[model samples]
Structure formats: C-alpha cells, structure tokens
Target: MTELLDATDSQTAMLADLVDSVRAVEETIARLSAVRDGMLAIASRIAVDVARQASHPDQGDMAVRSVAAEIGAAVRASDRTIERRMDAASWLVEAFPAVWAAQGAGRISAAHAQVIADAGAHLDHALHREAYAARAVEAASVESPNRLRRIARRIAEQFQPRTVTERHRDARELRRVWVKDLDDGMAELGMLGPAVLVHGMHDRLTRMARTITLENAQATKASTEETGEPDTRTTDQLRADLLADLVLTGSPVGHDSQTGVLGKIHARVEITVPVLTLMDDDPGASGSPPAELDGRFPIDTDTARLLAGGVTGWERVLTHPITGALLAVDRYRPSDQLSRHLRARDQRCRFPGCGIAARKCDVDHTHAASHGGETCADNLAHLCRRHHMLKHHSPWHVRHRRVGDDRGEHENDDTNAGRAGDLIWTSPTGTTYIDRPPQQNAVTFTEDNPP
Candidate 1:
C-alpha cells in the first residue's frame, strides 16, 4: 500500500509540473508572436516606403508584392499569406498600439489581439481608435478569442460615429452570392447579405430539413424491419438536399406538390434585444448599439424592431443587467424550451475552436444515454455533427466536469465562465482540453451613443 501511494504521489507531481511547463510554453509562444508581428510590421513599412520612392506609379503595387514574395520564400510560406500578414501586422502595431502592447506583454493571445485589430480597423480617427483599443484589449485579456470577437465588435460600434443602420444600408448595396470551385468535383456556394435575412434563410432551411428528417425516419423504420436497410442520411445531408431542391425546383423534394409557383416556407430565429434599445424612440439614431443576431453577431436595431413587429410569436428573455446571465425566458414554444436554452447558452459548437453556430449543431448527450446518462442540461451540449460523431466513433471522450474538479478550476475565468456546463474532452493520446462555454456577452445599453 505504501509503495502504491508513493507511485501515485510521484505521478501527481509530474503531471503538475507538466501543466506548469505548458503554461510557460504558451506564454513564450505569445511573446514570440508579438516579436514576429513587430518584424512583419517593419517589413511592410520598408516595402511600402521603397515602392513609394520608385519613379513609376503603376509599379508600386508590384514592388510591394515582390518584397512580400521574397520574404515568403525565406519563411516557407505563400506570398499572398505573407502579404496579408504584413498588412495585418502594420495595422496592429500602428493603429491599435494598446492591443499590440497587450499581445507583446503576453497578457492576451495573438488571436485575441488580431480580432481586436480587425474589429477596430474602421475607426479612422487615431483618438477614437485608441479609445476603442483601450477597452477592447482589457476585455481581450480575460475573454476567450471567440467571445472577444463579439465584445470587440460591440466596442468598435460604440466608437464609430455612424449608426449601424447607416452602415447596414451602405453595406446592403454590396450584397452578393458566389460559388467557389473545390476539389473532388464539388463546389461551395456562399452569400453575403443583411444578418437577419441570412440567418432567416438558414432557419427556414433547417425547419424544412426537420420535416424531411421526421418523414424519412418513419419510412426508414418500416423499410428496415422488412428489407434490412435504413436511410443513413444525416441532418446535415438533409439540409443540403433541401437547399439544392429549393433552389432548383422552388420547393423541397417531396414538398413539390404545392399549388403555387413556389411552396410556402417560413423561418424562425432567436433574436435577443436590449429592452431599452427596442423601446427607444429613435432606434436608428447614431450611437445606439446594435441588436444581437442569434447571439453570434450584431445586427441593426431597425431590423430587430421590424422582425419583432412582423413575427407572430417571440420569446421574451430577461438577462441580468450586469453579469449578462440569462435570468428567464417566457415560453413561446414550450416543447422546445430546453433546446432554445441550449442554443442561447452554447452559441457555437461546444467543440474546442469550432465556430459553427449552435442552431445548426446536434444537441448531443455528453454521456451516452444508452449507458444511463440522464437527459438534462448538465448531460447535454450542442456539438456540430462532425464533432458529435468524433466523440462517439473515435477514441475521443468527453464529459462535464464536476464543480470541484481540479481541471475545472484551471479553465474558469470571468470572461469564459460557464463552468457548470463546460466540457472536458480527452483525446486518444490521453491529453485533455477543456472547452468552456462562450461568455454570454449580451448587447446591453451603453451611455455612449453614436454621433
């Protein structure tokens, strides 16, 4: 017994030491990233300065590209990627000094600093940019990069003199859809549009997919019992099928029996509003912060109000004024109460580093229900189908850590706190990573309004 205890003690100490070493390594990497950004920023300046000194004006762009390509070869990276890095580095070091400084000091990760720089890029005035960075960097220091994105955007909106509505209107003119060719004879189709409309279109497709999935499940059960074959199409596959059918035939595959030129389709999406913003006499007035769309990004208040007015049913969610925690939600669809809460809580896939929106994810049981895992929030999470399958079919394991678990303490911080529901994922190699629930940074009332 004594030898066994000693062996366990030694193992614990070794693990603890490894954890400390990993933290140290992460800090060192952050510092190195800062140094690299500084060097890239200087390189960008040199390239631009040299190009400006050239006699031929048209050669300026080519000159810069030549410099980027030269550097890219030395770094073993692509010229286009290096050129983008140069531009990003220059913007970060020159425009958002506070964010750059934070990154250099290892107070924030490079991803955090980069997103802040990106969010504040449109703040043309030095003073306004400085003010935005000061607040954004503070948030970045504590928030995960994903949560920081939303916070940074909201912070930037406050600093911008123009209202979101004005920007939205101007941006609307540039809306478009395009296709990009891919390997394996496949292609990716993308669209850029107003946030509400884009999300609404997705929601409509999801609704149609659910309908098709239910019908397929019933048919598959009857056919499988007789013929020993089942429909193996996933929800994601169904959604894709629905999208293609709707685009090509003006209705879903089996739903083509409708009388009209196009079959009826409706979309449902959750939109959270600051009570005050919705009640404001002038929502479009400059300085009013934007409403949140699906808890992922900001949308103009005018659109939020318009949707609220036209919708037949809407849930009223009350969140804490200070902590931004969800307090209560009035039932609009009582049957979907748990699902709605999960979507709002897990704004994206629970898989570490994945940003696929939660509405599109499968509500998976962390512990297999077949093994007696209860069906509840603690046991449930939104996982993109990819990761959902990975958890079940691969050696990767996942579970919700208990409150006092030592692993839980390391992952909980004010900016990323959702400990009760956070997941501890273990890889095939026995390494573990905690994926904390993203901070529910609700759009709230701010004293500063747009000019």
Candidate 2:
C-alpha cells in the first residue's frame, strides 16, 4: 500500500510538469511569431524602397512580385501567399506597434494581435489609431480573439473622425453576392451587404425552420429521440433547405399558404442605442458613440433608428453614464425584467473565452437551484448549451463575483471596470480564470480633442 501511494504521487508530479512545459512552449511560439512578423514587415519595406529606386518606377508591382517570388522559393511557399503576408505584416507592424510589442512579449497571442490590427486599420488619424491600439491591446490581453474582435471594433468606432453613417454610405457601393464551387458536389453561396439586412434575413430563416420543426414534432406525437426518426434533419440542415427553396421557388417545401413563410416570418435583431445617438438629427455634428448591432459590433445610427421605429416591441435599457454598466431596463411584459437584464448584461455566453451570442444561449445558474441556489441576477448568467452542460457535468466550476474582488490581480487594467458582472471559473487542474462581461459603451475618445 505504501509503494502504490508513492507511485501515484510520482505520476501526478510528472503530469503537472508536462502541463507546465507545454504552456512554456506555447509562450515561446507566440514570441517567435511576433519576431517573424517584424522580419516580414521589414522585408516588405525594403522591397518597396528598392522598387521605387530602380531604373523603372512604373513596374513597381512587378518588381515587388519578383522579390516575393524569390523569397517564396527559398521559404517553400507561393509568391502570391508571400506577397499577401508581406502586406499584412506591414499593416500590422506599422499601424499597431504597441500590439506587435505585446505579442512579442507573449502578453497576447498572434490571433489577438491580428484582430487588433484589423479593427484599427480604418483609422485615418495617427492619434486616434494610437489610442485605439493602447485600449485594444489591454482588452485583447484577457479576451479570446473572437471576443476581442467585438471590443476592438467598438473601440475603433469611437475614434473614427467621420460618422458611421458616412462610412456606411460609401461601403454600400461594395455590396455584392457570389458563389464558390466546392468538392463533393457542393458549393458555397455568400453575400456581402448591410449588417441589418443580412442578419435579418438569417433570423427569418431560423424562425421558419423552427416553425416547420414544431409542426413535424406535433405530427409525429413525439420528440426526435423517442420517434427514432432517421429522416429528421438538424436545424442547420433545415435552414439550408429552406433557403434554397425560398431562393428558387419563392416559398418553402410543401407550403400552400398564399402569404407563405417568406411573408409571414420576419427577421428580428437586437439594437443597443445610446439616447444621444438616437435623438441627434445631424450625424456629423453629433459626437455620440455609434449604436451596437446584436451586441457584436457598431452600426450606423440611421439603421438603429430605422429598426427602432419599425419594431413594435422595445426594451428600454438604462446603462451607467460613465462605466456603461447595466443599471435597469423597463420590462413591459410579465417576468421579462430578469430576462431582459440578463440578455443586456451578458451579451454572449459567460463561459471563459466563449463568444456565442446571448440570444442563442440558455440562462444558467452559477449554483444549482436544486442545491439551494436562488433564482436571481446575482446567481444567473448566459451560457451556451455546450458550456451549460459542461458546467453541470464536467470538472469545471463557476462562481459569480463583483469587479473589485479580482481587480488587484489585474492591476493597471481598465477593461473590467465596464463589466456589470464577472465570473470566476476554476479548471479541473485547479487553475482559475476570470471572465468578465464585454464592455458596453466603453468609448475612449479624448484623443480627438485639442490638447
């Protein structure tokens, strides 16, 4: 018995050592990637300078392509791929030096750095871009690349000199649709247009699929599991089928109604509007922050107002004037006060690094209700189905905490101050990670003023 206990202790120590080594290797890789990006950026600048100083200035594109090809051959990559990487590296290193440095120190990953660079790429002023990089890097340090994207976009919008409406007008000209053929007798269809229009179209499709699914379930008189129906398709498959049917025949499969699903079902989207933005008549004169679309990214005030005007239902969300934390929301319907507040506070899944939208998630209790957990805002959070199940069945455990509880650990970080709620998650390995709600209305725009 003594020998077996010693062996078990040795194995546990070995496993812990292996985990630490893996983490160190990951950090090393991130640092090396940042260094490589700097090198690529330098190479691109040199290539451009050489092309400009050459005997023929008009052939600059060809000259750079030749340089790219030469480097690609030595690196075992395609010339076009090398050229693309060179351009991207130049953009990242030049536009967001702070982000690059953060990545070099392994404070943030390459993916996080790229997301920051892309978010601020549209800034026309140097000061605005610099300010954006500073806050974006801070936010990216603690967030996954997916979650950071939304935060970065909001930060970028705050610094834009031109209003979102003007940008949206110019961007509308580029709206288009295309089809790409794929292997195995399949093809992908894509569309690029206004976010409001695209998201609405998708929402309509989802509602139609749900309607059809409910009707089918009623006819069978049982759920998919009990019926053992092999013909039953997933929600995604149903949406695709419905989309193809609607596009080709202007209706869904087996539809006989004159109005049809297309006419009956409508798209729904969540729009978070600032009172100033909504009330302002002049887009250029108003300094209000841009409205948020589906709690993901910024949208023009025009779109937000239009949606607000047309919609029959409205939930008035009141946020803190400074911290942007949710204070209250007017719930007209019964038992909607908690639901609306949770949705507004937790814009996405509260699971660490999860980016699934709140609308698609289930409101889960941090502590089980069956175990004496009360049904209140303090004990509730939005979590996707996957994470919700994991919280209940897996080794992971989550607890709700206020902002100041862990503020000391993240000294000099201002991102957490904007969150209305925070969750402390402990992994099976006993490592804890803090997940805070995304910052809402956290616009830093002092850089635009006269110093």
Candidate 3:
C-alpha cells in the first residue's frame, strides 16, 4: 500500500511526473519482453541442436518433444504453445536474423516476430525473405501486430504467387464455422472464408445492427412519450438478437410491412475478380486466385461467382495495380462521393494509431469547409465520432500535403492526379508527425502479370 501510494508521489512531484513514470514503465516492459522472446528463440535453437545429437534412432524427435514438454510443464503452458515457440525459434534462427536482432533490441515483440515467421512460412527459402524481413521489421517497430500481419501477408503474397490454387484448395478443404465457451460462461463464434465475403458479411451485420438499433431507439422514444417508459435493452443485446434473427429467419427482428422497410439490408462488398475468372474461364489454366475481399481477403473464384449471381448490382472500385492506389468508384450519390473516396482511400480512421474502420467514420475536412476548405479527396480523411469531435473541439490540428517528385511541398495537383497525400499532425504538446494513407503495398502476382 505504501509503495503503491508512493507511486503517485503526492507528497512531492505533480501528476504529470507520475504519468511520465507510467509511460516509461510501458517502454521498459516492451523492451524486456522483446528481449525475452529473442532469448527463448535462442534457447529453442539450442534445444533443436542438442536433440540432433541423439544416440538412438528415434532420440532426435524424442529430445525435441521432451524439451518442449519440460518447458511447458515448468511454465504452466500448453504443449501446443511450447511446440509452436520451438518452431518459431528455428524459423527465427535460420532465416530471420534481422528480425531476431530486432526482437533482442526491443524493436518488436515475440508476437510480432511470430507474425513475421507465419507470414513467410508458406513460401520457399530465400524467396524475397530479406526484403520481407526488412519491410516487416520496419512496420513492426511502429505498427500494431494486426497491421504488421496485413503488411507481412502482402509481402508474402508477392513471393507465393504459385501457391494460389493450392491455398484456395486448402481453404476450401478446411472451411469451418464453430462456437466455443469462454471462462466467463459466455460463448464465442468464429468463421473463415474468402476475405471479401467475410468482410462483406461483417459490413452487412454492422449496418443491420445499426438499423435495428436506431429503429428500436425511435420506438422507445415514442413509447416513452406516450407511456413514460424507457428502453433498457443495450445496443449489444439488440445487435445479438438481430444477428440471431437473421441467421434463423433470414430477416431481422422489429421488421413489419407497415414500417415501409426495404425488406433487405444494403452491404457494400468490394471485390477484385479477374475478368477471366468471371467468364466460362479455362479450368486448365488455374483461375486467378480467389477474388480479393476489399483488396485484402481472398474469396475463392467459385464463391465470387456465387455472390455475383445472387446480387442484382454490386459497386465496383478500381485501383492502380502497380501502386495499389485507389482510383475511382461508380458514384451514384453526388453527396456521398467525398465520403466514399475517403473510405476507399483511408479504409480506417486517419488518427495516429487508431484502427476504427473507415466505413463507420465521419469524413472530416482537415481544413474546415466553412473556412474555404475545398471538398476534395486530398483535403478529407476519416475520423470516428470521438476523434472527429476531438479535432474540432480540442487543440489538435491536421494539415494535408501532397509530396511531389521533388519531395517538397507542392500543390494538391499531384494527389488530384491519383497520387497519395501526406497528413501532418501537430499535437497540443507542440510535437509534429506525418501520417500516410493506409493502402496495400503493390502486390505483383506473376501468374496474372507475367513479365
């Protein structure tokens, strides 16, 4: 208790000093944890080497398992976890020397290292391993593991072009959706499928959840005005009920003919299916690997066909194949053009370190529209409600700039020409940094773009 209270230093320094200490502690933890992961990898490599010197025929395998089991038992971990670490250790020791060094230097964590290993594990040796490591390590140094995984997968895809068919076949054979229980008496569900279809489903569900929630709120408001009652059902509960209703009945709850509802939900699913894949394509010539889900997930060509047949009309988005820069979309609503462009361009809130998806964001003008800011792509970005309010109500400032060929500040002409723009943020503390629009790295598939 005394030490805990002393942490505040109420009798001495101010609250800001206490906050600095906590921040310092976080850095120390990350550094130590990364070093510990590197040490574990070294230890795993030693175990494999030691096991290789076995005296008996089966001793090599036995030694490895025994070592893993012993470590797991000592650390109160599962055999699965220990064995995975053992494999990661071998992977790090052999091919990812730089990643291992970064781990030891506290630039990345074990989770980050493991993501790097998993990203390239599908490819043959020396297949852009050095390039992947360099790019992935740089990303891991600053980005979250999820972002690093996405970057690593993009890098891996460039080298694993030949595995497209095999990967799709594997995914088809391993297709599964399951549920499991958690420690708190709650249950969780999981699904794996073409990335586009999956994200589309998620996007649909989010919209559906919002739809029912707003209606329910309106109903509650009307009822309260009439009978003096309030709605106690939480939005999470409503979303869950809505999902169950959809899965079981193909229609969400709170729906009625009298409500003049569309009797359907609108989900914006962005996909990239090669032109040939959509035609009565040549089966002998392996179809383009699954259509990309929102330029990220893979939807097997067959499923893409199925989705195409089911939907009456789906929106199309175009991007530069070489640079992965979003180009254009079929715009039906003039008012929504700027919003859709921001979503397609940013894909997430542009706030530093924020991961809120752009679809659920407010398109904010970096320079206020009331102050002569033009309603153009370069001048706009996605910011969730909280961050959007923060930008306008708080001390934060954001500026949009297009870095031209000379790398100097130029006019927005370059971005208007389909190039990326840079966002400069100045913190209330007087520190400044640059943020770039998040886009997939240039993915070159030799099968499609044969040299």
Candidate 4:
C-alpha cells in the first residue's frame, strides 16, 4: 500500500511539472516568432542596401537609409538590449588593448572607444590591463557575456565625467594655479560667484576707506595746528564726542499736541544743555558761592530728543534678552512665534546647504496654502530668502515633521519626511530627489526654542 501511494504522488508531481514546461515553451515560441519577423524585416532592408550599392558603384559604400532605419527600429525595440551590446563592446576593448588600439586608429567612432577608454582611465595602465584580463577570465568561467558587459560599463562610468560643464570647470580650476597671483585671486573671486564676492569686497573696501579717511583727518588736524591757527577738534573726534555725550546723559523733551503729526520735516540746529550737579554743603569749607557748572555744553537737540524717547519707550519695543544692533522691530512681529521656534530648533535656516540664522530668515510654509496647507507650527520652516525662493520657485521641495512624531524621528529625517509628504522634486532629467532639511546650531536652537 505504501509503494502504491508513493507512485501516485510521484505521478501527480510529474503532471504538474509537465504543465509548467508547456506554458514556458509556449511563451518562448511567441518570443521567437516576434524575433523572426524583426529579423526578416532587417534582412529585407539589408537586401535593399546591397541593391543600392550595386546600382551606385561610384557612390562609395555608405550605409543606405533603409538599413539605417531598420537598425534604428531594432534599437528602439529594445533600448536595454542595445545598451548591453554597447557595454559588451566596451568590455572587449578593455580586455584586449591591441584591439582597442586598432579601433582607435579610425576603425570605430570615438563613442565606441570611449567606453573602454573611460574604464582604463580609472587605473594605472598596468593595473587596468590586469583588470581586463581578470574580467575576461571571469566571463569565460561564468559563461555569461551580459554580466561581464555590465561590469565593464559600470567601471567606465565611474571614471567618466557626468557632464561637460563639470569637466570644463575642473580644467579651468586646474589651470588657475599657473596664473599670476592677482589673476589667480581674481579667478578664485569669480569662482565664488559674482554677486556674493562683489558685495563682500565692496563692504571690505568701504571699511578700509573709512579707516584711511579717519587717519587723514587726524593728520590734517595735526598739520593745521603746526601752521598756528585755532587747534580745533577734528570732525571725526567732534562727532565721537557728541555721540558719547548723547549715549551717557542726553534726555528728551515732549511737546503737547492734540492732533497726530503728519508729513516730514528737515532742519539743522544746535542747543546746549548745562551740566548740573548738587553742591556739597560743608560749613567748615570757607569758600565763595560754588562755581556754577559749565552751561555751554553743545548738543544736537533732535538727537537728544530721540534718545530721550528711546529711554522712555525702551520697555515697549526692546526686551532685556534681545541685545545687538537693533533691527526693525515691527517687521519681526509676524514671525515672532516662528522666531522663537527657530531659536529652539537652532537659529539656522532649516534648508540643507543654508547656514543663515532664523533672525536673518523668513518663516516659510512647508506645505503651501494654495495646495490646502495649514499655517501651523508644524507646517512652518525657517529659511533664508534665497533658500526660501529656491524652495518656492525652483525644482525643490520641503517637508516638515507632523505634530505627533517624536523629535528624534524627525532629526535627520529630512529626505524621508519629504518623500512621505506631497513634497518631491522632479529634476531636469525627470529624476526625483528630496530636498534635505537644514542643520541647526546655537542660534537656530535659541530661535526655535524662544521663550
């Protein structure tokens, strides 16, 4: 009974195997039929070429249009197959230097030889020769042409420049070393990009010019004294003294008015505020009435009034913690919450490649409102104007973490998060990439975590 059951089970298994084999054979037959038809068309076109060659004996043996068309059709029919063929040719050239050299002597187009040349460019000639031999041996051992071809093409591309512009730029930079020092510096300056470097140079020159002007002014003052006129304070020195006086002790006076002031006014005038001090009442000191404090101290009335207002209204606009050159306080109102958040997140712009601080950035909406995005904290990101514009207008996308996710999950998850959302960039060649989030440091952290 056991033997009979075993035989029955084997028979069933054999039947199933037979059915699978038949299906596979049918598929193969269909493929072959297609190939046969394509080959027949190619042969017909080749025959036409042969006839053309015979008819135009003096025209030189050029490829006939019909044959070219057929070849194009074949390539279009299977681009992957054509790529594999090219790859195979490349491998053959690498494996046999003599063959490559013969081909380079004008037997093939540069494109055909490039694949091999590129592969060899990655290594010293001797090592490349060895690699080619190893590849040949591997192909022979495996009996796989496609595998060998794929490996060769990949190796070639590893040494080839991805674009012409990159190659040209690299060559130019290499040649820069032989240039004159000033010329080399200028070239480096331009390489940094005109807009950035020019602005920076302008600022630096302005600072140096100001320093020179101050020095010249002081020297002029010394010369004038030597010539024996009035030894008056230099303009810069006088300005400095005035500024110091205003900072130390100036006060503002308010004028009563019913209606709000309008329009603009310009005027120049000067006023003096006497330095006042309380007198010490010492009966033991026998002296005449204490000399009056100097009452001829000159002050700019407009500046003094402005300073007084700043002292009185300081609490309303300026916070104790916020210290530095004062930026426009009003312009910052809309993004105050975002500023705080950015401080906590670290004040840097939250876009990869951007290091601008939150204070120098605009609060951008990760998900645009036109696309039904909300204006919540989770949807906001700090980005400098340049990066913000890139995100909004360029082929770049941004994504921020959802409210519920833990901070760690979002921390360096810029690409993944962007993919999960509607944010995805289609590159120029139609390839897609996710724009990464920016890194944060102390400034960004404080901006993100503002109290």
lDDT of 1 at 240: 87
Please, what is the whole-model Cα lDDT of each candidate in the order they appear? 0.74, 0.76, 0.66, 0.42
Tell me the TM-score of each prediction against the true structure.
Answer: 0.48, 0.46, 0.39, 0.24
Which runs in model 2 stand beyond 4 Å of their true positions? 1-9, 54-59, 73-76, 173-188, 214-231, 246-451
Alpha-carbon runs more than 4 Å astray in model 4: 1-346, 393-395, 406-451
Tell me the lDDT of model 1 at 344.
Answer: 71
Sort the predicted structures by lDDT, highest score first: 2, 1, 3, 4
Candidate 1: lDDT of 128?
Answer: 99
**Candidate 2: tens digits of C-alpha lDDT, residues 1-451:** 5764656777989988999998788778889999989988888877677667865444455555545544554554655677888888888888888888998998888899889988887798888989999999999878899999999999999999888899899889999998654543245899999999999999999999999888887867755455555448778999999998877656454664765655556456688877677887974475677787667767777878888899767888876655566788785656678898889888988865556779999999888899999898888999987668657654567888754454433311345442337787665545555677777753333434421
What's the CA error at residue 442 for candidate 4, in Å? Answer: 7.5
List candidate 1 segments past 4 Å from native.
Answer: 1-9, 55-59, 170-191, 217-230, 245-451
Measured by C-alpha RMSD in angstroms, how accurate is candidate 3?
Answer: 27.4
lDDT of 4 at 241: 51
Query: Which tens-of-lDDT digit does each residue in 69-117 have in candidate 3?
Result: 4455445454347767777667775788788778766567767888998
Q: Specify the highest-TM-score model's number.
A: 1
lDDT of 3: 0.66
Write the residue-wise lDDT of candidate 4 on 318-338 in tens digits. Answer: 222322211222233355644
